[model samples]
Target: NLVPLLVPLFVSAFRRADELAMAMEARCYRGGYNRTKMRQAVITTADKVAYLLMILFLAGSIASRFIHILV
Candidate 1:
């Protein structure tokens, strides 16, 4: 029942992807050096704090898993 539904859904997705690729190709979008950022990326103090917090959170997560396993 679901297989019959999924086949057409997948076919439509692939067809749309092909169309998008063709449009991007026509516009000469090759990525890498061809791309330019509208705004320059600058790391601020807030960004540094956020990154530090994320790292601490991940480390705590991994440590918790190990602690759980050991106990």
Candidate 2:
């Protein structure tokens, strides 16, 4: 019953695991390497705006749910 529902998720995870293993072997990575990003991965203005929107939406949903439960 629920087994079928989990099949896709399991398959996706297995595929990701296989890809990760291949990546590790390709790099001969024994452990975490301290590498620097060529491009600065800074939070730009757009990212800040998007994050603010996400926070607002999450807060609104939580507040609404709390009010609903209380009522």
TM-score, one value per model? 0.50, 0.46
Model 2, which residues run further than 4 Å from truth?
1-37
How does model 2 fare in lDDT? 0.92
User: What are the candidates' C-alpha RMSDs?
Assistant: 10.2, 12.3
Candidate 1 per-residue C-alpha lDDT over 1-71 given as tens digits, one digit per residue, 9 for 90 to 100: 89999999999999999999999999988888658779988999999999999999999999999999999
Which pairs clash inside model 2? none
Candidate 1 segments exceeding 4 Å error: 38-71
Instruction: Encode model 2's per-residue lDDT on 1-71: one tens digit a residue.
Output: 98998999999999999999999899887764776558867998999999999999999999999999999
lDDT of 2 at 65: 100
